[model samples]
Target: MRVALWLAAEVGEGGRFVKQQLREAMPGVEQIDRRMRDLRPAGWAIMTYRDRAGLAPGELLLEKIGLPVWEKEHRSAGLRVITASTRRKVFERDGNRCIRCGILAGEIYPDETEVSARLTVGHVEAHKYGAPSGEENLVTECSRCNETAKHLAAPRFDERQVWDEITELPRKDKQAVLAWMAAGKREPSRVERVMSHVWQLPGVQREEIFRKLGRSLS
Candidate 1:
């Protein structure tokens, strides 16, 4: 609410601001950027340099004001509290991997090997415009993708390059890719599904299962 008020009264529509100003205004408020981001769901049009050209890094533009959440009647506007059960269901449905990037929980990122991926639930659609918190609307996402998606930023990969790579795939792989695109989420292969399940077992049980599988293969 304070962030909304500050943006509206201080920054005004189409005004440019920076992180330092926000910190100065809110002084010691934890996750001020996150607080500002929460307003996006309520119709606020805050734009970063990625969304708007000519702005330097760390600068932001308040393009429009959103819901008056401070008012009693609109306090809960554009926000939905997801239940714990729904989170569990979404994680299970996504095979405990990031549906967008296919990174498993605690796995190191392919690009940034030093950093491990952490899973979180995010809307399959843009949650900023009031996407529901139901299992159907949710999917497991890595922390990196979740932040990027919420900001409505351009994807890290080039579209033409991605398409070119996709076109070069073998016929069976192409078909699998097509299936994943049609479903809006990748279906883990049988082996991957089994591995996901195995990851959930106790350490000793997992070792026993792996040993039995090795014996069978032998």
Candidate 2:
């Protein structure tokens, strides 16, 4: 599990830094890829670096394991990775701001175990939108902030409707919207593809679409 989490967090990202980290975990590139794929069973999903979808459940387990007893810990709990460059570049763009409320990375990622840091990158839109996997669309965030951000981005969400709530959405989601506005594209689907449409629906209505998933509960 430890090896899988570290490797997934790093390899699944698909960037030079993450690649380097994965390589360190497994000396061979092929080995690293295989290891990342293994995380699927544990609930890890290789996410786009641009949004708050990177925190696959499997990786969450790993994050819990990766905490340093002396430093604040953050788990990439629910984000996506459009591209490895997206994560690295976004981290560079906002100077690593906490996606939720613009807190600095150092503040969240501080080297204090007692203090928890919820730092993670968030995508402006979920990858289901097929949003651009580019540098102009990524942001840094703390985990708590990111999770709340991801949750708020759900269902009939409109930034204009709630300014305070917008902060709750992932930084990546904000970046994605910004890119869309900059490009003059109003097709919300184009911004986040159908994800914007899904956001338009209430959480209950959306979750009901997954009725097939209920079979597992049976």
Candidate 3:
């Protein structure tokens, strides 16, 4: 709310601002950039260098202001509260792995070894205004993906290139891919499901199972 107020009162629509200004304005507030980005879902149109070629590396353009989140009636605007049950169901449905990146909860990111992935529920159509919290509309996502996905623009892939790659796959693989596409989600194979469950076990138990599986294979 403070972020919204600061943006409105200090930097009105069509105004340019920088992170330093926001940090100085909201002293001791953590993740000010993230808080500002949160406004995007509420119809805010903030453009960065990536979005606006004119913007400098450190600058932001407040193209438009969104809901009056500071106001009492609009305080919760653009935010969806997922129920505990819904979260559980969504996690289960996604095999407790991030649907976008396939990183399991507590697993170390392949690129960021120091960071362990944390799972969160996120909307499939996050950019859509008023996207629902229904199970069909939700997917399990890693925290990193959840935070960065909205900021990243869609990848530019040629339709023919994608189709050619798909066509290059074996017939069985092509069928599986088609099935996944039709379902709107890729179903985890039985081994992937079992591995996801195993990843949830205590470290010692997981190691023990790993060793047992290795011995059985031998």
Candidate 4:
């Protein structure tokens, strides 16, 4: 809590600070760096140079301070102690793909080619009060989607912009989109469900299956 107290008292919101400053302030305290990151889920907004322009490397901008974790009552806020078994079950259930965007591990995003997706387990209802850490409450998500879901940091399209595109779709396609919205999830089609399993096959097994399917088609 010393790190939190230091940030709260010393580095108020919209303040700029460096890593060295934090290190020097908390001498001999192992992993004080990680403590700063732990505050993020609790609503802290510490941005690196990559997150914002005009900042030098190794400098961070404290945009917002969330959930006074230094306080006694809020110490455990946003902390989810998920078990290993639960994590494995959720990943397996989701076919090791991000349930939010259906992106698989190490796959490049359609628009962003800079970094590939990495899988992580994320809560379905993030920041929900008294949320359980069970498999039912969790889903597989890419690191990007997990971060987006947490803060909704990405740019959002206006309802009119989205409605314009939706209106242009065929009636059946529009109905399909509405069904997905109402259900809060997009159910994979038969081909998609089969392809999801196929994508997980080993290289040799995948090649053999491909040859068999090709021969059957001919």
Estimate the lDDT of model 1.
0.77
**Runs off by more than 4 Å, candidate 1:** 6-40, 43-68, 71-74, 83-85, 111-118, 125-131, 143-151
lDDT of each: 0.77, 0.47, 0.78, 0.76
lDDT of 4 by residue, 1-218 (tens): 78878887899888899988988998987876567766755777787765555888888988778888777777876354565687789888887788777777788777675457777777777756347767888888876777677764675567899899999999999998888778765466799889878988998999999999999999
List, residue by residue over 62-91, the lDDT tens digit for candidate 2.
222222212222223212234456566776
Q: Model 3, stretches more than 4 Å misplaced?
A: 8-20, 27-34, 37-40, 44-76, 79-93, 100-121, 124-128, 131-137, 141-155
| Candidate 4 ranges with C-alpha deviation above 4 Å | 16-21, 31-37, 47-61, 83-89, 105-122, 141-155
RMSD of 1: 5.6
Per-residue C-alpha lDDT of model 1 across residues 112-185, encoded as one tens digit per residue: 74567878778777764456667887889886777677664457778898999999999998998888888866
Tell me the number of clashing residue pairs for each predicted model.
0, 42, 0, 0
Query: Sorted by lDDT, highest first, which candidate order results?
Result: 3, 1, 4, 2
Minimal lDDT window, size 10, model 1: 74-83
Q: What is the number of residue pairs that collide in model 4? A: 0
Rank ordering of all candidates by TM-score, starting from the highest: 4, 1, 3, 2
Model 4: weakest 10-residue lDDT segment is: 75-84
Tens digits of per-residue lDDT, candidate 3, 1-218, equal 78889989999989999989999988999988668756755767676664455788889988778888787776665454566798899998888888876788889888654567878777788746567768998899876676556654345467898899999999999998878767755578899879768989999999999999999999
